[model samples]
Target: MKKLNISVIALAISLVFSTGVMAQGMSKKDYKADKEKIATEYKSAKAGCASLSGNANDICVAEAKGKEKVANAELEASYKPTRKTHYQARVAKAEADYTVANERCDDLAGNAKDVCVKEAKAAKTTAKADAKAQMKTSDANATANEKSTAARSEAKTEAADARKDAATDKLNAGYAVAKEKCDTLAGTAKDNCLNQAKRDFGK
Candidate 1:
């Protein structure tokens, strides 16, 4: 159990590093090379497992396959650079750990082995749930950010429109006052004053 726990922790750490290539923007050539490397590593690991026997060999083989699965998932995640891809990587790690843990259970017997298998399954379930929750939270945060930016843009537009309205209202009021003053003038002078108000206020 202790060894399994350590393996789980180590897997988590390795997975975190495995996807670092995503930030670098991996190309098709690099991705292909990485896949080939992973396959070679898997073959080597399997060959190493041949030295073991019975349940031990089974456990070793399971671990080798699990690591390969995780490597592929991580490589895909790195190439895609999407939330769903990263979540897939996390799921892969969970499945890999669970497989290794399940195979190890073969070494035990009766209720103890059953318990171990159950614990492994539970661990896998929890990992998947956590990954899902993280993905949802990231999606929610992205939505919130978009909404916040939209709200700010709308506020700016509204403020600009309000300023234009205020300016128009002020000009209209000034024109009215100018026209009332023109009422005191007579004939041509009155006409000229109203013309000036009209021109000044753009009426």
Candidate 2:
């Protein structure tokens, strides 16, 4: 009787441990499935955006494609068990910065518009700096050579800055259009319209 009781207790403990392990395995599987689903949705959105016409449509498509890339990267980052948390945190920060920069650009006019555009560019620059810093830290932690890491960081920063400048130019053009439209407005309406344009253009 004593032997039988001991055997039963051992079996129960084994079953409990096995169940916990299986649950953990299932959780990981579920995470992968969710990531794949998100990537699929992003791909579909990218394809749909590509079908539109005109400069506005082209910009819209490009933005959608960029977003898709980000989504896919995030999904890939998730599967990297060792660095998943860190990469995700970095992505979140970068996204937040981009959003704030875009909103800032949306609010400005004339010289103020140019200044706002510059501010937005600066915001993007900061985000790129943070990303490069993070990359350098990662490379350092992985025992990469200092020269190689520095070179890569510099290249990345330069590219990001160039892109920011291009975006600033586009914002300046948009502000010009808004200014032209403001000429037709009158008195308080004109002032208000211009103010709103400045706010939108990041003046």
Which of the numbered candidates is closest to the native, going by highest lDDT? 1
Q: Which regions of candidate 2 are displaced past 4 Å?
A: 1-32, 39-67, 81-100, 103-107, 144-203
lDDT: worst 10-residue window of model 1: 9-18
For all predicted structures, in order, the TM-scores are 0.64, 0.36
Q: State the lDDT of candidate 2 residue by residue for 101-138, as single tens digits.
A: 34434334455544444444444444544555555455
Candidate lDDT scores, in order, read 0.70, 0.50
Candidate 1, position 37, lDDT = 79
Q: List the residue pairs that clash in candidate 1.
A: none
Task: State the local distance difference test value for candidate 1.
Answer: 0.70
Clashes of each: 0, 15
List per-candidate RMSD values in Å.
29.1, 19.5
